[model samples]
Target: MNQQRIDGGARRAVFAPVDNRARVDAVVRRIGDAIELGLLGDGEQLPGESELAGQLGVSTVTLREALMALRQQGLVTTRRGRGGGSFVSLPEVPGEERLKARLRGWSTEELRDLGDHWAALSGAAARLAAERTEPEDLVQLRRTAAELAQADEAAACSRLYGRFHVELAAAAQSARLTREQVALQTEVGALLCLVLGDGEYREEVSERLRFVISAVQDGAHESAREPAERCVRESTARLIALRLTL
Candidate 1:
Protein backbone atom coordinates (compact mmCIF):
# COMPACT_ATOMS: atom_id res chain seq x y z
CA MET A 1 0.00 0.00 0.00
CA ASN A 2 1.17 3.52 -0.69
CA GLN A 3 2.22 5.28 2.51
CA GLN A 4 0.02 8.26 1.67
CA ARG A 5 -2.96 5.96 1.33
CA ILE A 6 -2.33 3.78 4.36
CA ASP A 7 -5.20 5.33 6.29
CA GLY A 8 -7.04 6.87 3.41
CA GLY A 9 -10.41 6.69 5.09
CA ALA A 10 -9.19 8.66 8.07
CA ARG A 11 -7.29 11.10 5.90
CA ARG A 12 -10.52 11.86 4.06
CA ALA A 13 -12.43 12.27 7.28
CA VAL A 14 -9.81 14.69 8.56
CA PHE A 15 -10.02 16.96 5.55
CA ALA A 16 -13.77 16.77 5.11
CA PRO A 17 -15.73 19.98 5.53
CA VAL A 18 -16.04 21.44 9.00
CA ASP A 19 -19.23 22.25 10.88
CA ASN A 20 -20.28 25.79 9.93
CA ARG A 21 -20.56 27.20 13.42
CA ALA A 22 -17.03 26.32 14.49
CA ARG A 23 -15.12 26.65 11.26
CA VAL A 24 -11.74 27.80 12.48
CA ASP A 25 -11.65 25.80 15.69
CA ALA A 26 -13.11 22.81 13.88
CA VAL A 27 -10.44 22.94 11.21
CA VAL A 28 -7.71 23.12 13.81
CA ARG A 29 -9.13 20.20 15.75
CA ARG A 30 -9.72 17.94 12.73
CA ILE A 31 -6.15 18.28 11.54
CA GLY A 32 -4.68 18.11 15.03
CA ASP A 33 -6.54 14.91 15.88
CA ALA A 34 -5.46 13.35 12.60
CA ILE A 35 -1.86 14.06 13.46
CA GLU A 36 -2.21 12.49 16.90
CA LEU A 37 -3.99 9.50 15.38
CA GLY A 38 -1.09 9.07 12.98
CA LEU A 39 -3.45 9.39 10.02
CA LEU A 40 -1.37 12.39 8.93
CA GLY A 41 2.36 11.80 8.81
CA ASP A 42 4.85 14.15 10.40
CA GLY A 43 6.40 16.55 7.90
CA GLU A 44 3.66 15.84 5.36
CA GLN A 45 2.91 18.89 3.24
CA LEU A 46 -0.71 19.96 3.42
CA PRO A 47 -2.61 21.05 0.34
CA GLY A 48 -2.20 24.66 -0.78
CA GLU A 49 -4.22 27.31 1.04
CA SER A 50 -6.82 27.78 -1.63
CA GLU A 51 -7.14 24.07 -2.22
CA LEU A 52 -7.44 23.23 1.45
CA ALA A 53 -9.89 26.03 2.07
CA GLY A 54 -12.05 24.75 -0.77
CA GLN A 55 -11.82 21.17 0.41
CA LEU A 56 -12.93 22.20 3.89
CA GLY A 57 -15.75 24.36 2.52
CA VAL A 58 -14.35 27.28 4.45
CA SER A 59 -13.20 30.67 3.34
CA THR A 60 -9.50 31.25 2.85
CA VAL A 61 -9.54 33.67 5.78
CA THR A 62 -10.94 30.99 8.12
CA LEU A 63 -8.39 28.47 6.89
CA ARG A 64 -5.58 30.91 7.42
CA GLU A 65 -6.78 31.67 10.95
CA ALA A 66 -6.89 27.97 11.72
CA LEU A 67 -3.44 27.43 10.28
CA MET A 68 -2.10 30.31 12.33
CA ALA A 69 -3.42 28.73 15.51
CA LEU A 70 -1.88 25.41 14.55
CA ARG A 71 1.48 27.04 13.96
CA GLN A 72 1.36 28.80 17.32
CA GLN A 73 0.67 25.47 18.95
CA GLY A 74 3.51 23.85 17.01
CA LEU A 75 1.19 21.35 15.36
CA VAL A 76 1.97 22.88 11.94
CA THR A 77 4.76 24.88 10.36
CA THR A 78 4.92 27.09 7.29
CA ARG A 79 7.70 28.03 4.87
CA ARG A 80 8.04 30.74 2.23
CA GLY A 81 8.99 30.61 -1.49
CA ARG A 82 8.43 27.87 -4.07
CA GLY A 83 7.32 24.49 -2.69
CA GLY A 84 6.39 26.31 0.51
CA GLY A 85 3.23 25.19 2.30
CA SER A 86 2.02 24.12 5.70
CA PHE A 87 3.62 20.90 6.96
CA VAL A 88 2.67 18.71 9.85
CA SER A 89 4.61 18.90 13.09
CA LEU A 90 3.50 16.04 15.26
CA PRO A 91 3.07 17.06 18.87
CA GLU A 92 4.86 15.11 21.52
CA VAL A 93 2.73 13.08 23.86
CA PRO A 94 2.14 14.76 27.20
CA GLY A 95 4.47 13.66 29.94
CA GLU A 96 3.16 11.13 32.43
CA GLU A 97 2.79 13.74 35.13
CA ARG A 98 0.80 16.02 32.88
CA LEU A 99 -1.45 13.22 31.71
CA LYS A 100 -2.07 12.15 35.28
CA ALA A 101 -2.96 15.67 36.31
CA ARG A 102 -5.38 15.92 33.44
CA LEU A 103 -6.96 12.61 34.36
CA ARG A 104 -7.36 13.78 37.90
CA GLY A 105 -9.62 16.54 36.69
CA TRP A 106 -12.24 14.03 35.59
CA SER A 107 -14.53 12.61 38.21
CA THR A 108 -15.29 8.89 38.41
CA GLU A 109 -18.87 9.49 37.30
CA GLU A 110 -17.72 11.48 34.31
CA LEU A 111 -15.28 8.75 33.31
CA ARG A 112 -17.99 6.09 33.59
CA ASP A 113 -20.37 8.13 31.49
CA LEU A 114 -17.75 8.72 28.87
CA GLY A 115 -16.95 5.01 28.91
CA ASP A 116 -20.60 4.11 28.36
CA HIS A 117 -20.80 6.48 25.43
CA TRP A 118 -17.55 5.19 24.00
CA ALA A 119 -18.70 1.60 24.31
CA ALA A 120 -21.98 2.37 22.57
CA LEU A 121 -20.25 4.11 19.68
CA SER A 122 -17.64 1.39 19.28
CA GLY A 123 -20.17 -1.42 19.53
CA ALA A 124 -22.44 0.15 16.95
CA ALA A 125 -19.53 0.72 14.64
CA ALA A 126 -18.32 -2.86 15.03
CA ARG A 127 -21.74 -4.38 14.36
CA LEU A 128 -22.28 -2.17 11.37
CA ALA A 129 -18.81 -2.96 10.08
CA ALA A 130 -19.43 -6.67 10.36
CA GLU A 131 -22.63 -6.38 8.34
CA ARG A 132 -21.37 -3.82 5.86
CA THR A 133 -17.67 -4.43 5.27
CA GLU A 134 -15.83 -6.88 3.03
CA PRO A 135 -12.54 -8.54 3.88
CA GLU A 136 -10.46 -6.05 1.94
CA ASP A 137 -12.18 -3.22 3.79
CA LEU A 138 -10.64 -4.47 7.01
CA VAL A 139 -7.04 -3.90 5.90
CA GLN A 140 -6.67 -0.64 7.79
CA LEU A 141 -8.08 -2.07 11.02
CA ARG A 142 -5.72 -5.04 10.83
CA ARG A 143 -2.75 -2.81 10.11
CA THR A 144 -3.57 -0.59 13.11
CA ALA A 145 -3.87 -3.64 15.34
CA ALA A 146 -0.52 -4.93 14.17
CA GLU A 147 1.09 -1.58 14.81
CA LEU A 148 -0.49 -1.38 18.26
CA ALA A 149 0.99 -4.77 19.08
CA GLN A 150 4.48 -3.74 18.09
CA ALA A 151 4.40 -0.28 19.69
CA ASP A 152 6.81 0.05 22.61
CA GLU A 153 6.11 3.64 23.48
CA ALA A 154 2.99 4.68 25.35
CA ALA A 155 2.18 7.43 22.91
CA ALA A 156 2.46 5.19 19.84
CA CYS A 157 0.34 2.48 21.44
CA SER A 158 -2.36 4.93 22.53
CA ARG A 159 -2.57 6.60 19.10
CA LEU A 160 -2.74 3.27 17.29
CA TYR A 161 -5.32 2.04 19.78
CA GLY A 162 -7.54 5.02 19.05
CA ARG A 163 -6.82 4.73 15.33
CA PHE A 164 -8.19 1.20 15.33
CA HIS A 165 -11.60 2.40 16.52
CA VAL A 166 -11.59 5.25 14.05
CA GLU A 167 -10.84 2.81 11.25
CA LEU A 168 -13.52 0.51 12.59
CA ALA A 169 -16.02 3.35 12.23
CA ALA A 170 -14.75 4.01 8.71
CA ALA A 171 -15.22 0.34 7.89
CA ALA A 172 -18.89 0.80 8.76
CA GLN A 173 -19.01 3.25 5.85
CA SER A 174 -20.60 5.95 7.96
CA ALA A 175 -18.90 9.29 7.67
CA ARG A 176 -20.76 10.68 10.67
CA LEU A 177 -19.75 7.75 12.82
CA THR A 178 -16.15 8.03 11.65
CA ARG A 179 -16.07 11.71 12.53
CA GLU A 180 -17.63 11.08 15.91
CA GLN A 181 -15.03 8.43 16.64
CA VAL A 182 -12.27 10.84 15.73
CA ALA A 183 -13.63 13.49 18.10
CA LEU A 184 -14.18 11.02 20.91
CA GLN A 185 -10.70 9.62 20.54
CA THR A 186 -9.20 13.06 20.90
CA GLU A 187 -11.09 13.46 24.14
CA VAL A 188 -9.64 10.35 25.74
CA GLY A 189 -6.76 9.24 23.57
CA ALA A 190 -3.83 10.71 25.45
CA LEU A 191 -5.23 9.52 28.75
CA LEU A 192 -5.15 6.02 27.29
CA CYS A 193 -1.39 6.13 27.46
CA LEU A 194 -1.58 5.64 31.24
CA VAL A 195 -3.04 2.17 30.82
CA LEU A 196 -1.83 1.14 27.38
CA GLY A 197 1.73 1.91 28.34
CA ASP A 198 1.78 -1.32 30.28
CA GLY A 199 3.27 -3.91 27.94
CA GLU A 200 0.89 -6.64 29.08
CA TYR A 201 -2.22 -4.48 28.64
CA ARG A 202 -0.98 -3.42 25.24
CA GLU A 203 -0.76 -7.04 24.10
CA GLU A 204 -4.21 -7.72 25.50
CA VAL A 205 -5.63 -4.76 23.59
CA SER A 206 -3.94 -5.98 20.41
CA GLU A 207 -5.56 -9.39 20.80
CA ARG A 208 -8.96 -7.89 21.55
CA LEU A 209 -8.75 -5.79 18.40
CA ARG A 210 -7.87 -8.86 16.34
CA PHE A 211 -10.88 -10.69 17.76
CA VAL A 212 -13.08 -7.78 16.75
CA ILE A 213 -11.56 -7.93 13.27
CA SER A 214 -12.12 -11.67 12.97
CA ALA A 215 -15.74 -11.40 14.02
CA VAL A 216 -16.28 -8.61 11.55
CA GLN A 217 -14.62 -10.65 8.82
CA ASP A 218 -16.83 -13.61 9.66
CA GLY A 219 -19.93 -11.40 9.49
CA ALA A 220 -20.78 -12.14 13.10
CA HIS A 221 -22.15 -8.73 13.99
CA GLU A 222 -22.98 -9.51 17.62
CA SER A 223 -19.62 -11.19 18.17
CA ALA A 224 -17.89 -8.19 16.77
CA ARG A 225 -19.86 -5.80 18.96
CA GLU A 226 -19.10 -7.69 22.14
CA PRO A 227 -15.35 -7.45 21.91
CA ALA A 228 -15.44 -3.91 20.67
CA GLU A 229 -17.41 -2.80 23.69
CA ARG A 230 -15.26 -4.89 25.95
CA CYS A 231 -12.12 -3.19 24.75
CA VAL A 232 -13.48 0.27 25.51
CA ARG A 233 -14.99 -0.77 28.84
CA GLU A 234 -11.74 -2.44 29.90
CA SER A 235 -9.69 0.61 29.09
CA THR A 236 -12.19 2.84 30.81
CA ALA A 237 -12.22 0.65 33.86
CA ARG A 238 -8.45 0.78 34.04
CA LEU A 239 -8.51 4.51 33.72
CA ILE A 240 -11.09 4.75 36.45
CA ALA A 241 -8.91 2.64 38.67
CA LEU A 242 -5.95 4.85 38.00
CA ARG A 243 -8.12 7.89 38.52
CA LEU A 244 -9.15 6.64 41.96
CA THR A 245 -5.51 6.37 42.89
CA LEU A 246 -4.97 10.04 42.17
Candidate 2:
Protein backbone atom coordinates (compact mmCIF):
# COMPACT_ATOMS: atom_id res chain seq x y z
CA MET A 1 0.00 0.00 0.00
CA ASN A 2 1.22 3.45 -0.81
CA GLN A 3 1.92 5.56 2.22
CA GLN A 4 -0.53 8.14 0.98
CA ARG A 5 -3.34 5.73 0.20
CA ILE A 6 -6.15 6.37 2.62
CA ASP A 7 -6.04 3.18 4.64
CA GLY A 8 -9.09 1.30 5.86
CA GLY A 9 -9.09 3.16 9.16
CA ALA A 10 -9.17 6.53 7.46
CA ARG A 11 -11.83 5.36 5.00
CA ARG A 12 -14.06 4.23 7.84
CA ALA A 13 -13.78 7.66 9.39
CA VAL A 14 -15.95 9.26 6.70
CA PHE A 15 -17.84 6.52 4.86
CA ALA A 16 -21.62 6.84 4.94
CA PRO A 17 -24.61 5.09 3.45
CA VAL A 18 -25.05 5.48 -0.30
CA ASP A 19 -28.20 3.47 -0.68
CA ASN A 20 -31.20 5.42 -1.95
CA ARG A 21 -28.88 8.15 -3.17
CA ALA A 22 -27.48 8.61 -6.62
CA ARG A 23 -24.51 6.30 -6.56
CA VAL A 24 -22.12 8.67 -8.25
CA ASP A 25 -23.03 11.60 -6.06
CA ALA A 26 -22.81 9.49 -2.96
CA VAL A 27 -19.35 8.23 -3.87
CA VAL A 28 -18.23 11.74 -4.65
CA ARG A 29 -19.52 13.01 -1.33
CA ARG A 30 -17.92 10.24 0.69
CA ILE A 31 -14.50 10.83 -0.85
CA GLY A 32 -14.94 14.59 -1.06
CA ASP A 33 -15.95 14.96 2.58
CA ALA A 34 -12.97 12.88 3.63
CA ILE A 35 -10.66 15.27 1.81
CA GLU A 36 -12.37 18.30 3.30
CA LEU A 37 -11.86 16.95 6.83
CA GLY A 38 -8.20 16.14 6.09
CA LEU A 39 -8.86 12.44 6.47
CA LEU A 40 -7.23 12.26 3.02
CA GLY A 41 -4.13 14.37 2.49
CA ASP A 42 -3.06 16.21 -0.62
CA GLY A 43 -1.19 13.92 -3.05
CA GLU A 44 -2.59 10.85 -1.33
CA GLN A 45 -3.23 7.82 -3.55
CA LEU A 46 -6.68 6.33 -3.56
CA PRO A 47 -7.27 2.64 -3.14
CA GLY A 48 -7.55 0.65 -6.32
CA GLU A 49 -10.84 1.30 -8.09
CA SER A 50 -12.22 -2.17 -7.61
CA GLU A 51 -11.29 -2.28 -3.98
CA LEU A 52 -12.64 1.19 -3.36
CA ALA A 53 -15.89 0.34 -5.13
CA GLY A 54 -16.30 -2.73 -2.99
CA GLN A 55 -15.72 -0.78 0.18
CA LEU A 56 -18.21 1.83 -0.91
CA GLY A 57 -20.74 -0.83 -2.01
CA VAL A 58 -21.00 0.86 -5.34
CA SER A 59 -20.49 -0.51 -8.82
CA THR A 60 -17.17 0.20 -10.46
CA VAL A 61 -18.92 2.25 -13.14
CA THR A 62 -20.45 4.49 -10.54
CA LEU A 63 -17.14 4.87 -8.80
CA ARG A 64 -15.47 5.78 -12.08
CA GLU A 65 -18.08 8.43 -12.76
CA ALA A 66 -17.55 9.87 -9.30
CA LEU A 67 -13.81 9.98 -9.82
CA MET A 68 -14.31 11.71 -13.11
CA ALA A 69 -16.42 14.35 -11.44
CA LEU A 70 -13.80 14.85 -8.77
CA ARG A 71 -11.14 15.21 -11.45
CA GLN A 72 -13.18 17.87 -13.19
CA GLN A 73 -13.45 19.76 -9.93
CA GLY A 74 -9.68 19.58 -9.38
CA LEU A 75 -10.17 17.73 -6.10
CA VAL A 76 -8.47 14.69 -7.57
CA THR A 77 -6.15 13.75 -10.42
CA THR A 78 -5.92 10.48 -12.33
CA ARG A 79 -2.93 9.38 -14.31
CA ARG A 80 -2.04 6.20 -16.11
CA GLY A 81 1.36 4.45 -16.06
CA ARG A 82 3.70 3.15 -13.36
CA GLY A 83 3.36 4.89 -9.99
CA GLY A 84 0.28 6.73 -11.16
CA GLY A 85 -3.11 6.50 -9.54
CA SER A 86 -5.85 8.77 -8.31
CA PHE A 87 -4.36 11.41 -6.06
CA VAL A 88 -5.91 14.01 -3.79
CA SER A 89 -5.41 17.62 -4.84
CA LEU A 90 -7.12 19.82 -2.33
CA PRO A 91 -8.12 23.20 -3.61
CA GLU A 92 -7.34 26.43 -1.88
CA VAL A 93 -9.73 27.48 0.82
CA PRO A 94 -12.50 29.70 -0.44
CA GLY A 95 -12.06 33.46 -0.20
CA GLU A 96 -13.69 35.51 2.54
CA GLU A 97 -16.31 36.71 0.10
CA ARG A 98 -17.41 33.12 -0.41
CA LEU A 99 -17.54 32.59 3.31
CA LYS A 100 -19.58 35.76 3.73
CA ALA A 101 -22.03 34.66 1.09
CA ARG A 102 -22.43 31.26 2.74
CA LEU A 103 -23.04 32.78 6.16
CA ARG A 104 -25.55 35.31 4.85
CA GLY A 105 -27.71 32.45 3.65
CA TRP A 106 -28.19 31.06 7.13
CA SER A 107 -31.09 32.04 9.37
CA THR A 108 -30.64 32.78 13.08
CA GLU A 109 -32.38 29.56 14.04
CA GLU A 110 -30.21 27.52 11.73
CA LEU A 111 -27.12 29.11 13.18
CA ARG A 112 -28.26 28.27 16.68
CA ASP A 113 -29.06 24.73 15.66
CA LEU A 114 -25.58 24.22 14.21
CA GLY A 115 -24.11 25.74 17.35
CA ASP A 116 -26.18 23.49 19.61
CA HIS A 117 -25.27 20.42 17.61
CA TRP A 118 -21.57 21.31 17.68
CA ALA A 119 -21.72 22.04 21.38
CA ALA A 120 -23.33 18.72 22.12
CA LEU A 121 -20.77 16.71 20.17
CA SER A 122 -17.78 18.59 21.55
CA GLY A 123 -19.09 18.56 25.11
CA ALA A 124 -19.68 14.85 25.07
CA ALA A 125 -16.31 14.18 23.48
CA ALA A 126 -14.54 16.28 26.09
CA ARG A 127 -16.35 14.62 28.96
CA LEU A 128 -15.60 11.16 27.65
CA ALA A 129 -12.00 12.14 26.96
CA ALA A 130 -11.57 13.03 30.61
CA GLU A 131 -13.18 9.80 31.75
CA ARG A 132 -11.63 7.36 29.31
CA THR A 133 -8.25 8.76 28.39
CA GLU A 134 -4.89 8.20 30.07
CA PRO A 135 -2.32 10.94 30.49
CA GLU A 136 -0.47 9.94 27.34
CA ASP A 137 -3.66 9.91 25.25
CA LEU A 138 -3.72 13.69 25.55
CA VAL A 139 -0.37 14.22 23.86
CA GLN A 140 -1.90 14.76 20.43
CA LEU A 141 -4.64 16.90 21.96
CA ARG A 142 -2.09 19.25 23.50
CA ARG A 143 -0.01 19.37 20.35
CA THR A 144 -3.00 20.13 18.15
CA ALA A 145 -4.13 22.87 20.51
CA ALA A 146 -0.67 24.40 20.50
CA GLU A 147 -0.52 24.37 16.71
CA LEU A 148 -3.90 26.07 16.48
CA ALA A 149 -2.64 28.73 18.85
CA GLN A 150 0.36 29.55 16.71
CA ALA A 151 -1.12 29.03 13.23
CA ASP A 152 -0.87 32.42 11.51
CA GLU A 153 -3.03 31.75 8.45
CA ALA A 154 -6.81 31.43 8.59
CA ALA A 155 -6.94 28.07 6.82
CA ALA A 156 -4.12 26.62 8.90
CA CYS A 157 -5.67 27.77 12.18
CA SER A 158 -9.11 26.50 11.21
CA ARG A 159 -7.77 23.06 10.25
CA LEU A 160 -5.77 22.73 13.46
CA TYR A 161 -8.66 23.99 15.56
CA GLY A 162 -10.97 21.45 13.98
CA ARG A 163 -8.32 18.80 14.52
CA PHE A 164 -8.37 19.44 18.27
CA HIS A 165 -11.98 18.28 18.60
CA VAL A 166 -11.27 15.24 16.45
CA GLU A 167 -8.28 14.37 18.61
CA LEU A 168 -10.34 14.85 21.74
CA ALA A 169 -12.93 12.40 20.43
CA ALA A 170 -10.22 9.89 19.57
CA ALA A 171 -8.83 10.18 23.06
CA ALA A 172 -12.21 8.92 24.26
CA GLN A 173 -11.27 5.68 22.49
CA SER A 174 -14.63 5.39 20.81
CA ALA A 175 -14.45 4.81 17.08
CA ARG A 176 -18.02 5.97 16.59
CA LEU A 177 -17.39 9.16 18.47
CA THR A 178 -14.27 9.89 16.47
CA ARG A 179 -15.96 9.36 13.12
CA GLU A 180 -18.94 11.50 14.09
CA GLN A 181 -16.57 14.23 15.18
CA VAL A 182 -14.80 14.08 11.82
CA ALA A 183 -18.08 14.39 9.95
CA LEU A 184 -19.23 17.32 12.07
CA GLN A 185 -15.89 19.05 11.70
CA THR A 186 -16.07 18.78 7.91
CA GLU A 187 -19.07 21.09 7.82
CA VAL A 188 -18.13 23.26 10.74
CA GLY A 189 -14.50 23.48 9.69
CA ALA A 190 -15.40 25.35 6.52
CA LEU A 191 -17.52 27.76 8.52
CA LEU A 192 -14.78 28.30 11.05
CA CYS A 193 -12.46 29.55 8.32
CA LEU A 194 -14.75 32.57 8.14
CA VAL A 195 -13.80 33.76 11.61
CA LEU A 196 -10.43 32.15 12.40
CA GLY A 197 -8.42 34.76 10.49
CA ASP A 198 -8.14 37.12 13.43
CA GLY A 199 -4.93 36.55 15.38
CA GLU A 200 -6.38 37.71 18.72
CA TYR A 201 -9.47 35.51 18.40
CA ARG A 202 -7.33 32.52 17.43
CA GLU A 203 -5.21 33.07 20.55
CA GLU A 204 -8.31 33.31 22.71
CA VAL A 205 -9.69 30.10 21.28
CA SER A 206 -6.33 28.43 21.70
CA GLU A 207 -6.23 29.36 25.40
CA ARG A 208 -9.69 27.91 25.85
CA LEU A 209 -8.45 24.69 24.28
CA ARG A 210 -5.65 24.57 26.85
CA PHE A 211 -8.18 24.89 29.65
CA VAL A 212 -10.26 22.04 28.27
CA ILE A 213 -7.22 19.81 27.89
CA SER A 214 -6.13 20.67 31.41
CA ALA A 215 -9.49 19.58 32.78
CA VAL A 216 -9.28 16.34 30.84
CA GLN A 217 -5.75 15.74 32.09
CA ASP A 218 -6.97 16.16 35.65
CA GLY A 219 -9.87 13.72 35.01
CA ALA A 220 -12.43 16.42 35.54
CA HIS A 221 -15.09 15.33 33.11
CA GLU A 222 -17.71 17.90 34.05
CA SER A 223 -15.20 20.72 34.00
CA ALA A 224 -13.93 19.67 30.61
CA ARG A 225 -17.39 19.65 29.07
CA GLU A 226 -18.27 23.23 30.01
CA PRO A 227 -15.24 24.89 28.53
CA ALA A 228 -15.35 22.68 25.46
CA GLU A 229 -18.95 23.53 24.82
CA ARG A 230 -18.28 27.19 25.45
CA CYS A 231 -15.41 27.13 22.98
CA VAL A 232 -17.64 25.75 20.24
CA ARG A 233 -20.49 28.09 21.06
CA GLU A 234 -18.22 31.10 21.06
CA SER A 235 -17.00 30.30 17.55
CA THR A 236 -20.56 29.89 16.39
CA ALA A 237 -21.48 33.19 17.97
CA ARG A 238 -18.66 34.91 16.15
CA LEU A 239 -19.78 33.47 12.83
CA ILE A 240 -23.37 34.47 13.52
CA ALA A 241 -22.34 37.98 14.42
CA LEU A 242 -20.52 38.33 11.16
CA ARG A 243 -23.53 37.04 9.30
CA LEU A 244 -25.79 39.53 11.07
CA THR A 245 -23.59 42.46 10.17
CA LEU A 246 -23.53 41.48 6.53
- For model 1, residues 175-212, the per-residue Cα lDDT tens digits are 99999998898988978988988999999999999999
Among the numbered candidates, top lDDT falls to 1
Give one digit per residue, the lDDT tens place, for model 2 in 49-84: 999999999888889999997886677999899998
lDDT of 2: 0.83
C-alpha displacement of 211 in model 2, angstroms? 0.5
Q: What are the Cα lDDT values of the candidates?
A: 0.87, 0.83
| Model 1 TM-score (2 dp) | 0.64
For candidate 2, give the lDDT of residue 152.
Answer: 91
- Evaluated against the true structure, the overall lDDT of model 1 is 0.87
Q: Which stretches of candidate 1 lie above 4 Å from their native place?
A: 1-94
